[model samples]
Target: MDVDYELIRTREVRSQKKINFPDKVQRNVSFEHRAHGESVEWHYEENEGVAVISNDRLSDERYVHIKRANVMDDGVNIRPPNDLIEDLSRPIYKGMTTVYLAHEDMLEGDIRSVYLLTESQAFTLIGERTDDSKELREVLSNTPRFLPIPE
Candidate 1:
């Protein structure tokens, strides 16, 4: 059986995920993506939370240090950054998947090094693309916990 779904390019993908929290309390969720002698620090802040996610991986000029701010309580909406949509060739990852949440757009790239960040852990969906429909059907049949994103 062939799987039919809407696959949007990374640049055009918009996330339905949102962050809501109290303004007075400082909530910091920090994670490090260190590899190939490059240590990249990622943080989830209040107002800047959405900005960080959309900007970090997609920007041409990487941020050396993302400034953390505490501001009035407001809901932060997440979406793919403008730069990413304009340029589909930006390098977010090479052959391997990073620790960050895998946006659905990653699947549309030439290198389908897609990683899905779940509640408890992360899953890699690399090297799943193939020209042979028979082989592709076999792989998808046995795959676990895979779900299509709703538009």
Candidate 2:
């Protein structure tokens, strides 16, 4: 079966906020959210590179919450932590001008997907996955930009 993949370009505005942890709990983590709508917000942990969607007005009862950790090492000399490479072999975007679209239901949960992405697309997906995380942004900024390979 051929599957349709959608390019995820994050359009949300992100901002940092102070989190009040429980009085006895000791943790060092920065918090932020990319607002999707009035009832949905995308939150991420900067240090851990994990993100989740919090939807307050969800009407569906069968919906499950899933957390995703974006590839932190940029797949250069490093590989995705654990087995993500086997799971998400397809890059979200392929080439400079390539784009893919699919219904939200077509993509979900922990699963392997197929797509190849251009360098720019990789950057965009990385930005979305990390919620525009500060550390990764710094790493990406310091890295040199390259032209996408022609197909």
Candidate 3:
């Protein structure tokens, strides 16, 4: 599936989903192109090497969406993306799913190779690639260094 994730702010979502997640938290917002009425946002928490699904959401206008998945040692407790669940316990796996990030080599993009980033970095190579350098660093500065995903 070709998902063109748009980085929107809480304000932009006002006319869209209407739900307000904490700002500065990076999210891979998903929307159905054909069906313009429905939308879902996958809120994730980036741990060291793992991106935890803090919440799997659905729009009031739309229903057929995979709820959030939880990552646990023995087994996952949350709902899995229908396509992703091989009837197993893996919570978050974007197999074949594309991540739109400019910095495909950074710890964030390294979590998933097919990432989405800035237009400039999309074509260029190397060094501090993110949606916006100033904005990204600002976000990172506030994010706690719990478990930084290693390179």
lDDT of each: 0.28, 0.27, 0.29
lDDT of 3 by residue, 1-151 (tens): 1112223222221221122332222333222334432233233222222122222342323122334333222221112244423322223232222123322222232122112212332223223346574565444344433213343
Please list the Cα RMSD from the true structure of every candidate, rounded to 1 decimal place.
Answer: 15.5, 17.1, 15.7
Give me the candidate number with maximum lDDT: 3
**Predicted structure 2, TM vs. truth:** 0.20
- Ranked by TM-score, the better of candidates 2 and 3 is 3
Compared with the true structure, the alpha-carbon lDDT of candidate 1 equals 0.28
* TM-scores for the candidates: 0.21, 0.20, 0.21
Q: Could you tell me which 10 consecutive residues in candidate 1 have the lowest summed lDDT?
A: 22-31
**What local lDDT score does residue 54 receive in model 3, on the 0 to 100 scale?**
24
Q: Which ten residues in a row have the lowest lDDT in candidate 3?
A: 10-19
Q: lDDT tens string, model 2, 1-151?
A: 2222233432221122112121111111111224421122223222223322332212223222233322212211111222322233232221223222122232342221212233345555545434344544444444333111122
Deviation of model 1 at 61, angstroms: 8.6
| Clashing residue pairs in candidate 2 (N, C-alpha, C atoms within 3 angstroms) | 90-115, 91-115, 93-116, 93-117, 94-116, 94-117, 95-118
| Candidate 1 vs. true structure, TM-score | 0.21
